[model samples]
Every structure is written in C-alpha cells, then in structure tokens.
Target: MQTIWLTEAEWFAILRIGLGLWWLESWRHKDKKDWFAGGGIRWASGIADKHRWPFVRRGFDLVVKPRPRLMAYIVAYAELALGLGLVVGFLTPIALTASLVLSLIYLVLMIHDWAEQGQNLMMALISAVGLFGASWRSWALDDTFGLFLQ
Candidate 1:
C-alpha cells in the first residue's frame, strides 16, 4: 500500500477523531439552559406532531412526549458523552454504534428536511467506517488500555 504521512490506522484514527469533533460541535452549539428546560424536546415534538408519518407521531408521543424533560437531557448529554468517548477512544465501538443509531434516528425524524439530512447521513457513514476500520487502534486510548482488542 502507498503510505502517506501516517499509517492507515493513524488515518482512520484521525477520521474517528474528526467525527468526534463533529459531535462535540453539535453539543457545543446547543443552548443548554433552554434544552434542559424542555425547549429542544418541545421543538422535536412539534416536528413529530406535524410529520407525515403516523408512526413518527405515535412513537414520539408514546416515548418522548410523555417525558419531555428527561428526553431533552438524554439527547443533550448523549452527544457530549459520545463525543468524549470517540475522541479519546475510550470506548470506540460503543461510541460509534451509539452515534450511528442516533444519526439514524435523526435522519428518520428529519426526513422532510433535506438540509439536515446531509449531516445525519454523513455521521452514520463515518460511524460505520470508523467502527469497521477499528480506528481506535492507532491514536485511541482503547489500544493503550487494551480494551476490546483480541
């Protein structure tokens, strides 16, 4: 293989780290006070209410609407945690999988919004690539701690 400045593993690690930074950026841009006060969840609920899919509306009302505050906290903190985990490679596979799931959920919920769907699609793709590449093996703490390495 033609090598660059870094080995293949290192490059993959960089990709993983970049994705982690994206998650961090997502978390950083949120207004925590308003999000914690249920503003974010309320906004999502409003979208769900108007969604063309009946399943989206019913599922949200059943799972999120009844607990707006809790869901808000979950969504906000989950981003932070996933970002930290991925950046440090503390739990790369878990972080990548969780991010994939979250991205898929976001993709589905915002299917009507073409603009936001792009980010969701990219996140999901990156998560899958990083997970399959074992990106943590190079610059990740997972390697140092010997976590999930056969």
Candidate 2:
C-alpha cells in the first residue's frame, strides 16, 4: 500500500486560497454604514476597552479613534486587495505579510477575548508559514510571471 502526502507547497496553496476566500466573504458581508460610519468608532472603542494592554488601548484611542472613516476605508480595501492577491497567488509573500501584521494587531487588541485571540493567532501562524516557506512561488502568479523571486 502506498500513502501519498501532500507537499508543503500544496498545503500552503490550499491555506492561501482558503484565507483569501474568508477575507473576501467577510468583505462581502460588511455593511457600509456599520463599517465606515460611527459603528467603526464604537467597535474600536469596545475593543480598546477590552484590551488589557495600556499601550494598545492608548494607541487605539489616540490613533484609530481620531480617523474612524479613514481606518475603515483602509481596512476594507486592504482586505479586498489582500484577498484578491492571495486567491490568485500573486505577490503571496506580500499578502501573507500584510495578513500577519493585521492578525497581530487583532491579537493585541483582542487579547482579553480568548476566542478572538486564538483565531488571530492562528491566522498569524498561517501567514508566517506561507511567507517563510516561499509558498508564493509555488502554483502562483509570482512563479508564472517571474516576480519576487529570491
């Protein structure tokens, strides 16, 4: 009997596509009024309140609270762009890096919430693996187009 195991590249490709679809779906479900208007501020404030780290709380209050609309737009568009990049395996490393950064931010802000923290931690791990394994070069536009080759 022969057992076949998927290669790391294959696993990473699956992960990339899955994560991309998750982000895309999340974006698709968002309501503009809730994401871009006062709702964003309220959500940020709730997260800041939940954060035990004073630095993170202060950062959210000082930075995020001041420009809720801008932050909302940045987050919404970034998710869409990252989703597209990851789904098409284009610039995978860059998309993964961005995912990692966003995951870390969420982890910090939601540390007090075990469920959210765990989810963000998992995302960060996935991003790290994809970035370090050079999965972008496998089954990706970067490979076909000869872009970002190390």
Candidate 3:
C-alpha cells in the first residue's frame, strides 16, 4: 500500500471544516420557539439542576434563568458565526478559541451525561489542537485578507 501523508495545513483545514460543520448543523436543527422560549430552556434547566458543580448551577440560575431568550439568541448566533468563520477559514483562531470555550462549557454543564460530556471534551481537545497548530492562515480567508494576525 502507498503511504499517505497530510501536511499540517491540510490537517488543520479538515479539523476546522469538520468542527464548523458540526456547529452549523446543530444550529440549523434548532427551532427558535422551542429553543428560545420553550422546551429547550426546560431541558437545559433540567440538566443545570442536576449539575454537580455549584458554580455552574449558580451561573445557570443567575444568567440563563434570568434571560433565557437573550441567552438562546446569543448561543444560536454565536454558533452560526463560529461555524461560518471556520467553514470560510475566516478569523480561524478566534473561531477555534470560541469553539473550545463553548465545548468546555457544555462539558461542564452536561457533566452527568457521559456520552455528551465526552463529546464536548473531544470537541474542546480538537479546538485546542487547531489553536496550537496555528495553521489557520495556511488556507484561510484571514490569511488572504491579512486579518486577525497573532
């Protein structure tokens, strides 16, 4: 069999696109009514209620409960923006960092669910890899446009 090797840039591109699509698909499937004002809040509250971390529980109570609609909109739009940024290879470092943060938050909030929490952890790790690789400029719009340099 022939050996197949991928360059660091190619690997980063794949990770970026994959993670972007994951977020994009998640946002696409959400219904505004349910997510912003109805079932989604209830589901999230249930999970928050079960969260073992007192800080996370308090955060949920202080922020999510007080302004769930605003939070929902923020989450949805952030997901969309991050997904688009990754897919288009724009502001890649920022997108990756945001992905990592969001993933960690999910992992912490959903600590009771091993499967979901594991996925969140994996996503966080992937984001870390993408960030540390610093290959965002290799095939990205940011490189083309000379934006978000670091």
Candidate 4:
C-alpha cells in the first residue's frame, strides 16, 4: 500500500482523543473529593465570580449561585460525562455538542466579566476545535458504525 495522509475525519478523531483525554484527566483530578471541598464545583464557581458582566455573572450565578457545593457536583458530573463520552467515542455528535455548549457558555461569561477579556479567545478556539476537530472518526464508537461526517 502507498502512504496516505490522514483524512479530515481521521484528523478530527485524533483531536477528539487528545481533547477527551485532557478532560478525563481533569475529571479524575477532581474525583479525589466532593466538589465543595476545593474540587471541580468550587473551581467553576470561583471562576464564575470573576465575571464582571451583569448578565453573564447573573447567568453563572443562577446556575451555581450561593451554592458552590451544588455547583461543584454539577460541574464534576458534566465534565465526567462529556469527557468519558468523547474519549470513548460513544456519541460524537452529542459529546461534541455538549463540549461546544459548555465552552461557549464559558466564553460568554469571560467576555462579559471583562470588557477586554482575553479568555474568550481561548474558549472560542476550543469551541471551534470541537466543531471541526473531526473527532467522530478515530477512537470513538461512532467509527464502528461508519457514521463519521465524511
């Protein structure tokens, strides 16, 4: 067989695996304790507090307001679900959609927090990666069914 460069879908699948691993590692790091005890939820709430924009902060506050502990649980679970799904390639469309939504929400909050916020750029990039990373082709279960976007 002749050498062949990776297809777009293949590249996306590779990206999916890497990103999924990154999220999984993050979830594992948070699994050591309850979210309220300086874990994932607390981390998410703390970041939310930094948002200075009224509507944005308000939105985050509504999700985890006055309850960092609860927020912790939600964040941890969400991360776990999204991370695991992406890593395992069980549900590429759903996993990628969830990742994109979460990242987009974070982007909005960050930009609202600071008129000159720089975090938004990073979030935007991550969202784009989820959208185009072609992650449904590689290590995912979607690949087994021949359901890649190709």
TM-score of 3: 0.90
lDDT score at residue 26, model 4, on the 0-100 scale? 61
The Cα error of candidate 3 at residue 97, in Å, is 0.9
TM-score quality measure for candidate 4: 0.71
Query: Model 4 over residues 46-97: C-alpha lDDT tens digits?
Result: 6667856667667766756677676666666777887788778877777777
Rank the candidate models, highest TM-score first: 1, 3, 2, 4
lDDT of 2 by residue, 18-130 (tens): 87887787678888778887686678788896777889988988988888888899888888988898889998888999988988987888777897776688878888887
Q: On a 0 to 100 scale, what is the lDDT of residue 125 in model 3?
A: 87
Q: Which pairs clash (backbone N, Cα, C closer than 3 Å) in model 1?
A: none
Pick by lDDT: 1 or 2, better one: 1
Q: Tell me the TM-score of model 2.
A: 0.89
Query: Model 3: clashing residue pairs?
Result: none
Candidate 3 lDDT over residue span 1-150, tens digit each: 122587767777788888889889878999877887756767888989888888988999998888877888888888899889888888899899999999998888888888797678888988898888765756788778888663
Q: 1-150 in candidate 1: lDDT tens per residue?
A: 336888888888888999999999999999999999999998998899999999999999999999999998899989999999999998899999999999999999999989899899999999999999999888889999989772
Top model number, TM-score: 1
Instruction: Give the best candidate by lDDT.
Output: 1
Residue 49 of model 4, lDDT score: 71
In candidate 4 the C-alpha lDDT for residue 5 amounts to 86
